[model samples]
Target: MCKEKIMNSESEKDIKISKRKTSYPINSELLDYLKSYDRAFKSPIVYDDLLRYVDNYPILDKDENDTFWQGVIYGPQEMSEIHQNLKKIYSRLTSDGADKSVDHLFVDSVDYCTFGNSHPFRIKIKNQFNDNHDYFYVKKADASRIYGLEIEYILSPNRINFLVFENTLVEEHISGIPGDVFIEKYLDEHTNKIRLAKEFVKFNERCFLRLLGDQRSYNFVIVLTPDFDEMQYRIRSIDFDQQCYEGKINLYKPQFFRENLDYVKFVTENLDESSIKQYQHEERALMAKRMIVGKSRLTKLLRVMKNDQIAPREKSFQLKTEIFELLKDNEVLKCETMGDIVEAVLNFILRNYQTSMTKLF
Candidate 1:
């Protein structure tokens, strides 16, 4: 859990992140699972190697705002070698370790971020010939984050591409406008707001069902698609460090966050309770279908999780009890681990996807 505090008595609601969290190492079982699923790769460069930067400078966005990233500088002797290895690792993540596609790519910039639990190093690679650029991240491996990424890939509509090395993790960047920026700049400009509203409800439901927490406005993104008639919107989570770790029930629900009050307002003003319930039902049914398709993989992953220590025992027990009160199901009460709770919740969704959504509200 993020040693954070939420003040619901004051204004609307406020959530603040505290200092460092307890680090959980990747156990043997999770490593085996990654290797079996081909998500394990041997990278020539590890996370500690990137920490050798001799100096760093603060970075700024085009709008002259702080981007919360530091432009890392490395010694000339080590810079060339590190960038080359990073490019190759990017190749493995994108093309299953083929380097032929990356001969023209050059590392443009390397930046380090201290904003989240991962404290990841972001690499920007650009095509020398066409100037087309892309990004990937290198971060210390944590079992909780790895589980979040895997579950999101399997259950969510978005596709996640990532790899796990010994103590390192490599992940492709999720492309979209940040949720906070979208809400601030574009929310008033669009005449057709119903599509975004519906997507928000589904997005809210998706996070709660999967127990993904701390999704304030900035933790997610908004992807806009051009439909035949109107614009279609999809909400995606960019950060996955808080997966099933928080003790509070409202923390898993995005609608309860203070930063997301604007979105909550939009949802409440435009969507009726019945419409919201219908969208929740639709999202659950879709998840049930996905679960059926990814049964084998999900089963193996959950088995590893059931025996793993992703969160403190006290927190898990608290969340489990809270969920049991809502579900009135003995299965949730019988859960001894967060993994078991997740598995039971999944079974509940499979069994009551169409009928039990009424309890969600």
Candidate 2:
């Protein structure tokens, strides 16, 4: 009798567990659509989702008393708003809808996973703005779990596999560097194009200085042309939403851009030792400083602000003061390049912290 009772209890528990489970599987069609966007299969969020999917992620059981969803619901009203926004974006791309088709399609996938409510189906569309233009990635506002703010990412038609870079914070800003810049060929035929090397570095440096922090891979891209010359390199920023705000943008600063002409010249010469020692030293020190300051700033800002990345007025003022003190004295203040400025600010923070600790002890 005791053994039968134990067996019965185990069976009941398994049945209850199975009944409570939810599956947010990515169907073949959805995977096909994602591939059509030409994006890397492995996204940071997607990886996290996959782990949950495989490991039987926990979700709250629906309460019988509270029949209403707690979070922001797209339920008809929000969907209309999203539709209007898409129409507006579509109209901007085309004055008249004659050139191509604008098709709205729905795929059975979780649009969002939030604390209150989750959207089980995702709405996507194919926009043919023009002949040469690429299809745009579209998404609607879905209630967020980690951050209440709507989380969305525009899918790109042209994608590059950057797995080798390990997806750092800085790499997300750039798309690809120009790949065709052979030194021998450029010198023999087109020497003027050599100036592009400096311009490329300068553009990235300016962007880096403007952001102040957050440098990682997948944020930036380096495209090298066939010749292997630095001058012919084309650099493009992939992520811009995080330009001025806190984590609101999810981007990195452009401090990693190499600026020194001698360094560029050495790279052009195929990694010669002319400025190798100085280059390596500067790179290491700058990298160390960037990590320290970036992490410190992120932690301090996060403490003061919620998911919105906005802090109270008084808190903002205090943060600014702290940051100011950290960066009051550093050689990077004199730097003309974004790369140099980042290094300078990093050094400032490190020096400040060390000095303060010394006095305290």
Best by lDDT: 1
Query: What ranges in model 2 sit over 4 Å off?
Result: 1-89, 94-133, 139-200, 223-231, 246-252, 256-361
Q: Scored by Cα lDDT, where does model 2 land?
A: 0.31
| Tens digits of lDDT, candidate 2, 61-178 | 3443332212223445544545444343333333333323334322112222321112221223333443332222222211111111101121111222211001111111122532
Worst 10 residues of 1 by lDDT: 1-10
RMSD in order of candidates: 4.3, 20.9
lDDT, model 1, position 243? 83
* Candidate 1: tens digits of C-alpha lDDT, residues 1-361: 1101212322444654435666689999999999998899888989999999999999988888998999999999999999999999999988866778889999999999978789999999999999999999999898888999999999999899899998899999999989899977787665466778788789988998889888888999999888888888999999888888877777788877788777776666677777877888889899998998999999999999999988888888998999988779899988888898889989999888545655787
TM-score of each: 0.93, 0.29
Scanning candidate 2 in windows of ten residues, the lowest lDDT window is 143-152
Q: What TM-score, to 2 decimals, does candidate 1 have?
A: 0.93
**Candidate achieving the largest TM-score:** 1
